[model samples]
Target: MMIRDVKDMVKMYKLLIRFSIRSRMQYRFNFWTGSFIAAFIAFMEFALLAVILSRFGTIQGWSIAESAYLYSVLTLSKSIYRTFASDVHHLEQYLVSGNLDGLLLRPLPVLLVLMTQNVSIRFGELLLGFGMLAYSLGILAGKGQIELWSAIPLTLLISLNGALLLFGIALATAATGFWLTRISMLQNLTEDATHTAIRYPLTIFPGWLKGVLTIGLPVAFVNYMPALYIVRGEAGPWILALSAAASAAVVGAGALLWRTGMSRYQSTGS
Candidate 1:
């Protein structure tokens, strides 16, 4: 059964890849233009931060470089996640039109099928963002703010956690599609919330709001706390362990919610 499941997933992935390539081929000009537009958006976001820093030398005692450090990791993780799980972000359409039934009929996990269903050519935007992130990391290293060797692993972990957090939010949002049949508004709200948190230091917020963003929402675990630990050399083994544990909890909860929603699903079109 395991072998069959693996083979089925591989087949699905191959089909998804072929469809994605063909879609890109059919819309080559649009694909490139979309990539440029994506890149422009990322650049503008970073540029806005620069302008803000110019006006205020520090945010919550975090200098421009420190904020940039966090932003780089956040953006890099977002790019990677968006590139691979674009379908999760836009899952509402599937529920709204009962398209999910197609996935249910497949001999594979519905979530995996959904994940490999679409590939965003717009990841060109993230690739460009990564370049900026690398540059910022280099600047920090030059100032002796971080050691290159140790920073590498920390950065990777931070990025992975960020992706996990985004995936959790997306899965939760997607699960809502079962009830709402359309969830674009919720998706926008979650994405915006993530954007605001990741682009700046969370330390500036009031304690109450911080708690809301931390435990109530847990966005802090995505980037801020992890970055703090790495930058300050204050994170112990337990902190890292908690981050991993938190990610698992979120992912596990999301999966359960998604599966429950699926079980309740009734095809839209009669």
Candidate 2:
């Protein structure tokens, strides 16, 4: 049954991709323009980091180049997740119109269904962001900044961590629609908080604040902690262990939140 459900979810997404392509084609200019703007904004963020690093020499002992390397990995993860989970990321409309009824009729998990319903085809943006990160990582490697080859696995692990963490946050926000039909603000809040952690080294913050960001929210640990271990040598073996445990805990908790929300769900009036 689970396997079958997964297949159905894949099929649903294929259909949605077709539909979204057609829909987007109708407004090609807007789509392309929006894609360009988004890509530019993402790029500028890294540029800003570069500028700051040039003047300040280092951010809590993390050089500008090192920060860029970390940011690139974080951005890559975020852009990839956003591209695939665009629908789940913008689920308030489904809840508000009681459109979720249609999804519930399917055998697949509701979250998977939501994920497939909308896809971001901004491959241009994704490519550009990834390119910048790749270039940065190469520079870090050439400068003897990072140890041989471990960077790739570490980057992949943290990217997975960030994806799980963000998905959990989105799920929690979507769950809130059970009680409050409107959730645009909640989504914004989550994104804002996430970007904050992604943009800076977690160690720059105070100890208590760091604890909250690392554990309470767990966003910092996604990129910052791991990067520290690799880039700065501050990460002990125990810290690496804690990072994995923390990510798993968030995933488990987010699943529970979604399950609880589903039980309380009262479909919006049609």
Candidate 3:
């Protein structure tokens, strides 16, 4: 039975992928424009940051290359989440318009269906992130701060965990739509705040803000800790362990919240 269910899931996933691809292809211009705009925005952000850092030399003792590494990790993680879980980011629409009812009636899990609803055209962001990561790694390797071969694997692991952390946050926020019916403002505020906080080294922030980011929201573990260890070559084992634990805890809490929210959902009659 377990094997059969796994096969069914694979089949459903393939079907969803096919439909999503075809739908996107039907609007090729929109897809291209959206991707270009996203990439341009990311480029401008990095350019502005680079200009400021060039004037000041460093922030909180972090060099431009180190800051680039941190930004790459955060950007890559967010791009991955947006690509795979874009529907979850817009889950309020389903809740508000009664579309969630159709998803609930499917044999597969509603979460699975929601996640696969769209394939985001964020490839430009992904490409930019990889470029930044590669450039930063080269700089770090030249400075003898990190070994490229080992750092490659470690960075990939960190990026995956960070993406999972973001997904968990998005899921928990979306789940609130069950009660609020329009949680976009909350979602935007959380995402913006997190992006702002993680774009720089955590040490620059106040002790209280760092504590909140580490304990309350826990976004610090998503990128800052791993980046700190990678660039500084300190606390390697402890950072990895803590990051893993934090990712697990955040994702588990999000899943539990989502289940609870689903139980409270009262679908609109539309």
Higher-scoring candidate on TM-score, 1 or 2:
1
- Leading candidate by TM-score: 3
Top candidate when judged by lDDT against the true structure: 3
- Candidate 1 lDDT: 0.76
Off by over 4 Å in 1: 1-15
Runs in model 2 lying further than 4 Å from the true structure: 1-26, 236-241
What C-alpha lDDT does candidate 2 achieve relative to the native structure?
0.74
Which residue pairs of candidate 2 clash? none
lDDT of 2 by residue, 1-270 (tens): 999977876787788777876877788898888888888887887778788889998988877767876776677667767767778767778877888899899876787767766566766657765686678677778888776588777777777777667666667777777778788887777666666666788767889977777767777766777777776677665666677777678768877887888888788665
TM-score of 3: 0.95
Q: Give the Cα lDDT of each candidate.
A: 0.76, 0.74, 0.88
Model 3 lDDT tens row, 54-141:
9999988889999999889998989988887779998999998999999999878888899888777578898999999999999999
